[model samples]
Target: MSIDSIADAIEADAGEPIPGLREGLEEMRAGRSGRRYTPEQLLVRSARSTLGLSQQAFADLIRTPVATLRDWEQGRFTPPGAALRLMEIAVRHPEVVRDAAA
Candidate 1:
């Protein structure tokens, strides 16, 4: 396809009043485009990456064990009601997690 044809196709596929196109374009042009991750998400992803740990290893670090972590990540099982509270607290203040583990 010609350049104009390709551009038009892209615009059509993007759909609906340009959506966040303007904000995305501005961020790109300014070289400051990125995403925001929650602290919990960041901590979990970082621990997995930093230690070259599998899901199992990640579970071990958080003291939840491999199978339970897998269940949590996969949504197969909800952690115990209490564990969820602890997780939220640990996500907010990871040092508390370390101290508790110690």
Candidate 2:
């Protein structure tokens, strides 16, 4: 279809209800479906949040590059075993990690 025709059609359907969109939204609101993080992602994000540090600060504290930390948090890549262990310790004993970093 022509661009103008496509635009007109889009405008025409602006008020039309998308099939199952409402149901999907309701399911997400009720905690039935949404972006679910992997355990590793949760660990990395939780460790940073628990320590109240920004990504850069957390990366510095962990002695990893910020990009690598972002990759771990975004699930683009899994952290190495050592990093995982450190984050696990951070989660359980944030004070210890903080003191050690100091």
lDDT of 1 by residue, 12-58 (tens): 88764455565666676688957745454444554455445688755
Highest TM-score: give the candidate number: 2
In candidate 2, which residue pairs clash? none
Residue 56 shift from truth in candidate 2, angstroms: 0.3
Top-lDDT candidate index: 2
**lDDT (Cα atoms) of all candidates against the true structure:** 0.62, 0.86
Q: Estimate the TM-score of every prediction.
A: 0.44, 0.68
- The runs of at least 3 residues in candidate 2 whose Cα sits more than 4 Å from the true structure, single-residue gaps closed, are 1-33
- Residue range 26-63, candidate 2, lDDT tens digits: 67667796777999999999999999999999999988
